[model samples]
Target: MALLQIISAMAMAIAAPLFLGQPLFTLPVAAQAQWSRVHEIPGFGLGTWRSNGDQAAHAVEYALSLGYDHIDAAHIYRNEDETGKGIADANVDRRYIWVTSKLWNTDHQPDRVEPAIRQSLSDLGLDYLDLYLMHWPVAFVPGDGTELDRETSIVDTWRAMEDLVRANLTRFIGISNFSRRNLNVILDICDICPYAHEFELHPYLQQNDFVNFHKEVGIKVIAYSPLGNTNPIYNGRHGNLPPLLEDPFWKKLADVKGASVAQTVLAWGMRRGTVVIPKSVHENHIYQNMFSLEINFNVLEMYNISQQDKRARMNNPSESWGVELFADLDDHTSLDGNKGQEL
Candidate 1:
């Protein structure tokens, strides 16, 4: 049955390879072109990080129905099966929607890379992924929880990822949660520079310098946790900082624009040239988030938000991973003052 589905999907692709819909996918130019004008992923997408259980599928399906052209998933999320079911349940055509998944630390070994993506494809019920990212710069033993594997070379793992593009399993490749130091290493030697980099970015925790660096290198930024402190995983990690939605400045801005706080921040992320993936299970929030594209921030508003950068990083697992993440950025040792014993 899966084989038949693959054949049918291939036949469909051959018949309609030129996708010129809302979220466009430009055909790769020969060799070097792959490195240039890489992908046209949508500005807004639905995130499936803690979007687990039946709600995960429902959120994805509803988001797509509401005109979300992109969906982000990862193997570590452990909800790809539900995410796939949601995509299949949606009425929209697959060609119009962009799907992204990630490779977990445990699968960073060169030989394990291909099978890792294959497993993600199987769960997502797709013949190919629009983008696949390395979940983190860290690597771990296959079954060991948070046990670092210091021997695996990220260059070799990236080589395997580049091959996925050639094999037509994924259209583009990127990295997530990598600091400036980690990114520079890849930039120095990668055959195909990363097309995008996913990390935490919000009004309160904006890393302006790092964001600029990505722009200088031509890498698209995908902002996860765009709403700030909304993800349950960040329950106590914020250290007394008020929820971003309740910030007086942002609230005033949202009121002025006649938009919700969520909408305002999401628009800010897009206006600054980054992709924003805000997750939600409620139908109302999903509907509101999609229309964030319509919220235009004025020059002053943008400037004011920029001035609010607190450099308060929320999602750092350096201590647990035993490597200093975001080593060169603000709040590098925020989480438990973990200086990365291994590092």
Candidate 2:
């Protein structure tokens, strides 16, 4: 996989100028500015997956003030406009902020990819995104985030994503909620491999195999709900789950380390070499999350955290999607139907 990524990158390096009419190493000033922050994305990020209204805007402002450089959002999150306001209100240079959003499932069609990104860009009031992801590998009903569209192809969708890079709408493009099956497919046909893969990951749902797979293939693994999605949305994935913050085992570890449970968990994730985004709207929580890098966990503690995994997946799709997305997710090796387009 590493060899393939090297080859893919070399091909892109050679082909970029030939196809896009510029030196491969040289992009416009705006693009080059955003590109500089991609390396620091692994430590932490502020997630706005279900944030709403003006509060969402203020929360973004608070996060930015606390020194958070990465903001994870999605078009389906329905708060790009709010987040955009927050980014602007913060008075930070736009280039210094690392913004990521997703392409909605409804926009899986070849012709609709670019349009979906444009709307997100317009809503965010930004000219370009640091990273843009296909929110999910499965297409869905046009208006819903999870109502599956069984007819669309993920491979085709990715081709459109490649077009996004050429168009300079997103500095980099990626996938979220994709299983290994789906990622392998994208790599197979991609002239430029995806920069990262986002998925629901935490101590309880430690997807070690899948997480390691992504890194092995040269894709950075970005974790959403890094502390577990304790907040409910739609039908609610976090409601009845065990409170990771209050878990006695985890708490003991945090107490020993003089770290909060949230910090301990985030530290564990960073130690594993994946970028973990733990969402928060509160000022204290956001600030404490910023200091997570100061927290550390030893090998035994990491083993204990690993032992907490129950394969509990919080972001499973519903029957409304009309596809067996949850049960059959790992059964294939590619999108089979997961084609996509521009950002």
In terms of lDDT, which candidate is strongest? 1
C-alpha root-mean-square deviation, each candidate: 7.1, 9.2
Prediction-by-prediction clash tally: 0, 17
Clashing pairs in 1: none
For 194-241, candidate 1 gives per-residue lDDT tens digits of 999999999878898889998998999999999988777787876678
Q: Please give the CA lDDT of all the candidate structures.
A: 0.82, 0.75
| Residue 174 in candidate 2, Cα distance off native in Å | 0.6
